[model samples]
Target: MRRSRRVRFLSDSDIDSGEDDDDNEDDGDGEEGSSAARRWRRRMRMKCLSCKEEYGGGDAGTCRECYEEAGETKEELKREIDDLKSKVNFLRLLSVGPGPAGTSSVTRPCFYDVVLVASDSIDSADSECVSIPAHRAVLTSRSPVFRAMLENEMEESLSGTIKISDVSYDALRAFVNYLYTAEACLDEHMACDLLVLAEKYQVRYLKTYCEKYLMSRLNWENSLPIYAFAHQHGATSLLDAALSLIMDNMDKLSKQEDYMELVEKDPRVVVELYEAYLSKQVNTAASKDPKGVSRYSFQEKRYTHDMHMNNIIEHETTNGTEDPKTVNFFI
Candidate 1:
C-alpha cells in the first residue's frame, strides 16, 4: 500500500511541474510582446514641428520636409500678392473729375484730350453744364463705346467735348473716375447709376462690380425693384439673385407695394416670374416622383392648358371671329 501511494504522489508532482514550465514559457512570451508594444508606441509618438507638441501617428498632418515646403510656398504667394498690389497702385491714374480747385486738373491740354459734359445735370437748362475732363486713352481703354467714338473721329472727338445724356453731374463724374482709377465709392444710388452707365458703355468690369454691390445689399423690401432694374439692364447675376429672394417669399409677394407697382408697370415680367416658379415646381416634382411624373405637375399643366383655351375662346367671342390657328396647348 505504501509503495502504491509513493507512485501516485510522483505522478501528481510531475503534472504540477509540467504546468509550471508552461507558465514560465507564457510569461517569457508576454514580456517579449509587452516590450515590442512599448517600442511601437515610442515610434508612433513624435513632436509637431509647428506647435512643438507630442502626437501619435494618427494625429500627424505632414512630415517635416513637407511642412517646410508649405511654409516656403505661402511666403512666395504673399510676395506675389504684394508685387501685384504695387503694380496696380502704379497703374491707377489720378481722379478724373474736379480737383481741390473745384476745376478739373485733367483740363490741361498736355494731359487731357477729351471732356465729358453732363447734359442732364440738376442745373437749369440755360446754365452752363459742368464738364468733367478725362484722358482719351484711359476712356478708350476702359469703354468700347468711347473707343468707337474716339477712334472714328466722330463729332464729339472733333469738338473734344462728349455730352453724356440722362446722367446727373455726380454720376457722370463717378463714372469717368472709375474709367481712370477702376475704383469708386458706392452707395446704393451710385451703384445703380454706375450699373446703368456700365451697361450702356459695355464696361463689363464696372458692370460686374456694380452688380455685386447691389446683390450684396439685396433684401425682400428692395428685391422687386432690383429684379426689375436688373432685368432692364441685363444684369443676369443680380436678376437671378433677386428672383430667388422673390420666389422664396412668394406667399407674401402680392402684399408688397412694389409688387403692385411691378404688376401695373410691367405685366410681362410678372408672367415671366410665374413661369419660372411653375418650372421650378415641375422640376422638384419630377425629381421626387419615381416615374418622373407628379400629380401636381400634371394638374398644373392641365390648368394652364384650360386657361389658354379660355383666353382663346374669350378672344374669339369678343372679336366675333373663329381662328383654329390660335388654339395652343401646354405640354
Candidate 2:
C-alpha cells in the first residue's frame, strides 16, 4: 500500500514561527491580568473579629488563634457579669422590705430594731434633726463603732435611740440606707459629707466609696481642701492623690488662695508641703545628673537632717523622755 502524501498549507517551521509570534503577546497580557486580579481579590477579603466586618489584608488584625481566644475570653467575661448581677440581686433581697410611705418609724417592716437620731447642733438651743430607722444586726455587721456601742450595752443601746452628733439629717439617713443596702447615690457634696460620717463611724466600705468619688472628681481647684480633709480623716488614697496633684502644680502653689489660708490656719501643713517639694526637686536633679553635686544636694542634706531631728524628737516624746508638745512643728 502506498501512503498518501501529507497535505499542508505551509511548512512545519513556517507554521511554528507564525503561531509563536501571534500567541506570545496575548499570553503575556492575559497572564499579567490574571495575576493582578488574583492579588486584588486577595486584598479585598478579610474577617474582622471586633466589628465582624470584612476588610483587606492590609487592615487585618488578630490571627485565627488569637481571634478564637478573644471570643472565648469575651464569653467568660459575660458569664462573670451575669453571676455578679445575680449575687447583687440576692443581697438586695436579703435586706428588709419597704415599709408604709410617710411613716415616722419603720413599724410594718419590723426588721429594724434600732433608731438613729441626728443631732444637728450640739451647742444650739434649737437645731434641726431627723430620725433614721435601722437594724442592730446590720449596723453591727457593717461598722465596728456601732458594734462596740450596741454590744457593750451602752446608754444608746439601753435607750434604743442613738444620737449621731455632728451629722446632718440627710447624711444620717443616707448612711443608714447604705448600711442596709450597700448603695448610695452620691454627688461631690454628698460624697464629702458621707466621707466624714463614714470616718466617724469607721465604716470602711462607705469611706472607700466616698474617697473614690472624691478622687474621680479631683482637680486643682479642690485639691488643697481635699488634701486637708483627707489628712484630717486619714484617707490615705485621697491624700496621695491630692498631694500628687498639688505637686504637679507646685509652680502655682503660692498663687493659690487656699495655700495662703492653709499657711495661716495650719503652718505645720505648709512646712510639710515645702519639705516634700524640696525632696522632689532634689530627687529630680539627682536623676538628671547622677554624678554632678549641685545646690540641691546641700538643700537635700538640710532637709534630711531636719527630718532626722524631728524623728528623734518624736521618739523621745513617745518614750516619755521629752514633752510631746515640745517637738518642733516642722520636719
Candidate 3:
C-alpha cells in the first residue's frame, strides 16, 4: 500500500488550543521506517493562500477554491480602480487647461460664463472680495448649491458672478479647482474651511475627502473641537470618529482647554459624549460577563452593540483613497 503523508497546518490558535491530530505510530513495517516517514512528512509544506508562504495543513487559511476566488475578485477590483482613475485624470485634463492658449485640439476652453467671488479674504477689507473665474457648467455639475443658484437665475447668476460668503480667497480658489479636478491641498485649517464649503454646497465627495483628512490628523489634542465642529456641520462620519477617539482617551478629557470650551459653548455636545462613554462602559462590562449574568440585560447589551456597529459602518462607508498630491490650480 502507498504511504499517506501525515501533516497538519498551523493556525493562530494552535499554540493555545493544545490540539494535535498527528500521533506517533509504529507501523508493522518497523519503528525505523515509521519514524523516517514521519520525518519526511514533517518536512513537506504547502503554499498559504493568504500570505503565499509555505505551510502545512495546520496553517491553512481557507480551501483552495475560496482562495482562488478571492484572488480573482481582488484582481477585478484592481482593474476597476485603475479604470476609474484613468477616467478622472482624463476629465481633469480636458476641463482644466490654460484657457484658450494651451488647450488641446480635442477640447477648447470657452469663455467662462460665471465668476465666484470670495466674500471674506484675509488680504482685503470686508468690502473687497476676490474673484475666481470658472465655467458655469462645471460649477453647476459639481455642486447642487451652485446648480440651484444658477438654474433659478438668482441675482448672482443674473449678474454672471456668485458671491460666496464666509470663505477666504485661497479656499475659494481651491474649492473651484477641486470642482474641476477633484483634488485639493489640505492642511487642518484648510480642510476645516473646505469641509464647511463642501457641506454647504452638498459636495459629498469633497466633504468625505476633508473628513478623511481631519480624521487622519485627529488626536486627543484636537478631539473636542473637532467633535464639536463635526456635530455642527452634520458630518456624521467625522462626528463618530472624533467621539470614539475622545472616548478612548477620556482620562485626559478634562485637562484640555477645548474640553472646557466645549462644555461651555455647547454643553449638549459634552452631555452626548458622556452618554457615549457610559454606553461603551456598559457594553464592555456585558462582554466580560459572557454567561449573560451581567448587570445589564442581554437585550440591552445587544442593542448597544448593534448601535455601535452601525456607527462604525457609517464612519467606514466612505474610507476612500487619500487625497491626491497637491497640484497647482489653473487660475
All-Cα superposition RMSD per candidate: 16.3, 14.1, 18.2
Error of 1 at 36 (Å): 53
Best TM-score goes to which candidate?
1
- lDDT tens readout by residue for model 1, 2-52: 532333333334535634554556555787655654554455556777667
Error at 324, model 2, angstroms: 12
Please report how far candidate 1 places residue 168 from its true position, in Å. Answer: 1.1
Residue pairs in clash, model 1: none
Question: What local lDDT does model 2 show for residue 243?
Answer: 92
TM-scores, one per candidate? 0.61, 0.60, 0.55
Candidate maximizing lDDT:
1
lDDT at 32, model 1: 69
Pairs in steric clash, model 3? 8-57, 8-58, 9-56, 9-57, 9-58, 9-59, 10-58, 10-59
Please give the RMSD of candidate 3 to the true structure: 18.2
Local accuracy of candidate 2 as per-residue lDDT tens digits, 1-331: 0211121233446445534654554665777655654553444456677667664344348445656778889989999899779656535433433344533433244565677777764345433124566678888999999999999979988877788877887788788777766788999889988999999889998999999999999999999988888988999999999999998997787678797667545545656676787778778787888987497576766666566456545555555655435454442
List ranges where model 3 is wrong by over 4 Å: 1-110, 121-129, 290-331
Give the candidate order by descending TM-score. Answer: 1, 2, 3
